[model samples]
Target: MRLSNRNNKPLFSFIYSLVGIIFILGVIAYVLEISKFDVFGKKAWILLAIPSLLFLLLYILGRPVFEYDSDGEALNFRNNHILYILARKDAKDEFPKYKLLKFNIINVFVFKRLYVYILSKKNHIVILKYDINYLSKKQIKDLKFSLNKVVKANKEIRHEHEDNTVAV
Candidate 1:
């Protein structure tokens, strides 16, 4: 199964465009003599500051697109921002199902993340994180369901191995 929120790109773009247009219209109105409000002249800085602050707020709250693929023998997870320049390095991880140890989903404020724990070839535990802030509640539920299945399977497999092994 593959889950992704790439379709939201156009929606976000539209929102950004609308905000920009509103700011431009405010500037145009201020320049025209038709303006009578003192706020536009005496407090004109508010007009500029409002839009600038809005843009900054939106950028800070925006989250990267996330994808999870579990169709093949390995689980693939990817996180990348639509605007790559402001975003951190993209995160991508693929590991065999059998190596999965545990997984966790953490939510702090408006941000959400998925932490996948895997056993490395050197017998060390490796943790991979993927940003999942933009995912809907239903999508998050489905993700938890899928990861739970893997966790349960891993636990059973380990139990069988322990039972079959001889005392050291």
Candidate 2:
């Protein structure tokens, strides 16, 4: 299935946390002004503002958009109108590409931010993340099976095609 930033909890948590922090800072500033405290100078103020500003910028830009098949055979990534497709086969199960260079999975968290990396023989690399990518225990197992199947099938096909003299 396709996944995007909409309805993602991590993005919401980030935005809300940033706003909350800024609000807390504002309260502290008001309190300091009320107390007439000069202990924290301009440098301290600048340091405090930097993180909030960066978080605001991130919130404005929004989260990255991601799209992938639930079965893990194909993927499409779109950012700023640049679409990248990382598919090794068509619907007919034919090898559209010569070889898949490498496929790696990196776990960022137990239930969030799963990383999938794809490299092709033509020097193409696709890095995808399932940010806030949560699934049930059963769904996770299914996804694992699908991913393993795709990787194994593609590797065997690539090796067989590279070695023509070997009999079927």
- Clashes by residue pair, model 1: none
The sequence of per-residue lDDT tens digits that candidate 1 reaches over residues 125-161 is 9998887878999999998888888879889999988
Off by over 4 Å in 2: 1-5, 9-65, 70-73, 78-101, 108-145, 163-168
Off by over 4 Å in 1: 16-62
Q: How far in Å is the alpha carbon of 68 misplaced in model 2? A: 2.0
lDDT of 2: 0.48
C-alpha local distance difference test of each model: 0.79, 0.48
lDDT of 2 by residue, 30-96 (tens): 5675468666655446544765676554444333333345334444432221112212222212122
